[model samples]
Target: MDVEADVIVIGSGPAGLTAALHAHESGARNVLLLEREEELGGILKQCIHNGFGLEQFKKDYTGPEYAERLIEELEKTNVQCFLNTMVVSLSPDRTITAVSPEKGVFHIKSRSVVLAMGCRERPRSSINIPGTRPAGVYTAGVAQRFVNIDGYLPGKEVVILGSGDIGLIMARRLTLEGARVKGVYEIMDYPGGLKRNIVQCLNDFDIPLYLSHTVTEIQGKERVEGVVVSKVDQKMNSISGSEQSIPCDTLLLSVGLIPENELSKEAGVELTPITKGPVTTETMETRVPGIFSCGNVSTVFDLVDYVAETGMIAAGNAARFAAGDWKKGRNPVEIIPGENVRMLFPQRYSFKDDLILFVRSAKPIEKPVNIELSPLGMRLKRLYARPNEMIRFKVSRDKLKAVTGPIEVSITER
Candidate 1:
């Protein structure tokens, strides 16, 4: 079968669904949302924990609740949805090839495409932790699915590596499910997860947190056994004689999440080395004009609200691109990171509208830090944020209209 639409959004995650709804609302008559799973909700279906949709929905909700709200909203529109469909490849010319149980092999020619395939967690194999290939090691998300949705206990004893939100949440969940959580180990000097999660999930649960440490070796042979964790120096090297062994049947890793950009690469989209996603302009448009990306597929977001908001931007731009209403020749400005600032998104910026800059600090800050725009050295924004917190600052288009060179964001102790 051959399908045609003004906009084709890949993945039925929050990003894809929100993009579809936004595009349809923007008068894109033919918007299609495709999902590979049997259902519309993506990872959210397995995420039974609350703490989502405070910004978008104005109320705290579980992952499924947030996704259901968007799904209900989409039902009021003319947007079409394709479930159990997997997009195999994407072409630079806005062509999509996908297959499904019912449709077999199909083709889609969309004027604009939104790549919102979301992200996948990094596994133990990716980190090269030396040990016998065992059955106990699982990524935090996978473990989340198994425990939350599959109605099965992963393990009675657990040791989570990396203090990412998922791991922290799982530490609490496992404990609630009558599991013994040994501790959470993070390679960084501070927790990788949000401060709220560390407080609520780990600290409140009495789960020990080992910062600046890592699981250097896995001791399990066949079924399971234990792990060897060691403290790491500033350079991430294992400190001599600092090794400690903890016995546990299962090892959960929440090391990191990587944007699933294989299709982006196949479609020949230029990706940023920092985000590992497509290099998007302020409008979220990729180098290939009509192709836009958002959500975890572009960059890992700390909150789902930001993902949905970014999806709206991508979808709005995509709708305009499809309608041939997009104006060209906007001068682009680069966003450069300053001292102690890890990285910034939307590598290229346009002054056509207000732009929100999302950034992460290299380390935790105990004192207030001024986030200022430099080379004019104006203080665009300020926040007292820790390393685990992702800070966002909005620069109105009018504020950037007069600037010509790159926008520099700096952090200084106050």
Candidate 2:
């Protein structure tokens, strides 16, 4: 099969769904959306918890409900959507090779492409936690799918490693499902999830959270029988003589998330080491012209609202590119991460329009700190900052009207 479109979105997640809708709204005549999964909701289908859509829609909603709202809006558009379609390859020239049961092999040539494939959970093998080949080890997402979607429980007793949002939520979920949650252990001194999740999911449930701790080993053969937990120092090395054996039937890992950038790499798109996502400009355009990336595929966002926001930005730019109206920055200004800033997005600014800068702190900082934008002498006061919670600020073009140099973002005590 061979087809063509004005814009082709490569996933059916919240990002891709929004991208397709925005592409149509942006005047893309032929917008095509493809999803590898049988469903259109992506990971949100299995995420049964609430606390979503608060910022985007100004109302709280469950993950599925949030996705349903997006899907409903998408249905109102003329964008064509295909499910159970796996895009195998993407060319830099905006050619996509995909396969499906109905269309065994197909090629889609688009004027522009929007990559919103989102992200995936980091598995146990990635971290190399010493353990036997056990049947009870599962990533937090997989376990969530099993329980929430497939109507099956992983085990009766569970010990989760990593204090990520998913792990924290799963602790409460498993507890409510009659599973005995041992505790959640984190190698970092600070929790890896939002403060609200730590409070609502773990704290409210009376689940213990152990900081600066890790699972040194998994003690099981056929199935998980127990786990060996240990404390770690600042360097993250296991502290000797601090091992404690905890009996459990299952182990869940919520280590981290990595952008699904296999297609981006295949297309020769530049990727940043920190975000593990494509390097994009302020318009969410990749280095390769006519190709845009957004959502968790750019970075693991804390909120789905931000993911949709990026999709709109990328789709609008993609539509502009397709119409030959895309504007390029003149000598784009570089944005550098300064003191206590772990990561920053839109590494380069066009300096022609207002830009939203996303920043992540290197470590936890106390309240009354200032987020300083250098070279402009601009500062925004924040109560506190954490590596888990991202910082977003807008840099107006008025401030860059006379500036012709790079800008640095840093965090300092006020």
Candidate 3:
């Protein structure tokens, strides 16, 4: 069969749901959402943690509760949601090929599409961890799903690698569930999780955090038995004779996250080297005219509120683009990261509206620094910054009229 939509949002997570809602509210007649999972809310389904929705809802909520609230608001309208539907391919012409058990196979032609497939965890293979084949190793997110949703314990004794937000949260989770957490190890000198998470999940539970340390060898032929932790020098190489064996049955890794953009590649969208997601305009439109991207598909964010915000921006622009009223500004400026910055999203912009540039610092800056637009005199000062959390700079279009050539953002100490 054939289907059509004015706006087609993929992945019914917070981003996708909010995008579809915004598209409909912005005057799109036909909005549809397709989710590969059995239900809506994406990863939030298994994330039973309580540190969500504070920015959007002005109150804290568990993951499922936040999902339910968005779904409830979505259901109040007429946006159609197809669960267990996988979008197999997308074309530059905006034709989506999706498959489902009930529908057999179908094609959707859309005026505009919002890609919000979110991101996946970087696994052990990505980091090249030396280890025997074992059954007890899992990503921190996968272990969270097992414990929170499936009601199964992954292991009794755990040693977590990469003190990311998920890993940090799981440290507390496992400890509260009667599991013995040996310690949390990070290759970076600073904790990889947010400041609040580092305090609440690790320090509150009396869990030791070993920075500049990494697991060099995994010791097990079957289930995970232990890991050889080694301290790394300033250059990130393992120092000789610093190996310490930590006994544990399970290894939960939270090395990093990768944006899922295989379909974006299929659609021939330009991707940024830093964000590893699609290169987009300030409106969140990919180089391809009618397609849009947001949320983790663009860049992994620290909070769900920012994810929803990007979704809203993408959807509104999608509606405008579908209606043949999408505006383009005069000067097209390329945004780049300077010395202390790691990744910057919306790498290209035209100042269509008030723009929010999302960026991550390369390292921790304890002193006050200026977030500057080089040669244009736009600067925002901040007291502290870290790699785990992204820095957002919202600048008005009028403020950018003076900027010529490319706009580069640098964090410099005052």
Candidate 4:
């Protein structure tokens, strides 16, 4: 079989659906959303916790609730949806090869493509946590899905290996569900999750959080029995004689999320090493002219609101591409990371459109910080941000057009 659309979305997550919605509103009549999952909500279906949609919806909602709102909106649009379909590959010329049980194998020729495949958690094997392969080990997100969506408890006693948002949320959730949360360990001196999450999920639950620590080893054969944790020095080296062990039946890893870009790479899209997402411009257009990216697939976002906002930009640009109104020939400058700032997404910037630069600090900044553009040395924006928070600002096309050198964004304590 063969399919064709003006715009083809590779995922039906919030980013993809929002993009499809925006594309339809932007006058792209034939937009198709492809979802590999049996359902449309992506990982949100597993995340039942509240604290979502505070920005976009102006009200707090659970993950599923927020997704439901968007899904409902999608039903009123011209966007067509294909569930249980997997995009096998993509070509530079905007050709997509996908497969589904009912539709068999098919080729899709789209005028533009949006990549919103989102991200996946880093498994225990990726971190090389020396341990016997055990059955009780699960990523925090997976554990969340099991407990929240499937009504299944992962274990009775759990020790989380990272202080990420998922791990923190699970600590409270597992405890609420009648599990003993041993503790959450972080290799960094500070928590990896948002400070609010640390307070609400861990502190509020009285769950211990060990900072500057890591799981040195795991002791288990069939199921997780316990884990050996150790404090790390300033250099991240284990402090001598600071090892401790905690007995537990499960170990949940919430170390980090990595952007899903295998399909983007297969389609020959350039990627930024800092964010591990496809290199994009202000329009969210990737190196491949007709390919755009957003959401966790473009960069991990602290809030879903930003994902939806960015998705609209990608969708609008993709719609223009589909309408034959996309203009090429703009030279985009690379965004370079500087002091105190770990990395910035949309690694590349274009003067053709206003750029919203999203960045994270390398460490907590308690005082006000100035985000300045280097080389030319102009202050772009000022923010009072903690390391756990994300800072975003827009650079006007006029300002971007004035840059004669690479764009550098740095944070300096006020």
Q: Which of the two, 1 or 2, has more lDDT?
A: 2
Off by over 4 Å in 3: 328-331
| lDDT of each residue in 285-403, candidate 3, tens digit only | 99998899999999999999999999999999999988888766566789888879898888887768777988888989988888888877778999977788899879888888777
Worst 10 residues of 4 by lDDT: 376-385
User: Any runs in candidate 1 off by more than 4 Å, and if so which?
Assistant: none
User: How many angstroms is residue 215 displaced in model 2 relative to the true structure, after the best TM-score fit?
Assistant: 0.3
lDDT of 1 by residue, 1-414 (tens): 399999999998889989999999998989999999999989999888899999887899999998899899999988999999999999999899999999999999999999999999998878999877778999999999999999888999999999999999999999999999999999988789988898999988899999999998888668669999999999999998999988899999999999999999999999987788888877898888789999989989899998988899999989999999988866787888888888677778876568877887777777767887877566744547566777876777877777789877778787
| Model 1, position 386: C-alpha lDDT score | 68
Model 2 Cα displacement at 47 (Å)? 1.0
Report lDDT (Cα) of residue 280, candidate 1: 84
Candidate 2, residue 244: CA error in Å? 0.2
Worst 10 residues of 1 by lDDT: 376-385
Compute the lDDT of residue 203 as modeled in candidate 2.
84
Query: Which residue pairs in candidate 3 collide?
Result: none
- C-alpha TM-score for every candidate: 0.97, 0.98, 0.98, 0.97
Stretches of candidate 4 above 4 Å error?
A: 380-383
Candidate 4, residues 75-113, lDDT tens digits: the string is 988789999999999999999999999999999999999
lDDT of each: 0.88, 0.91, 0.91, 0.89
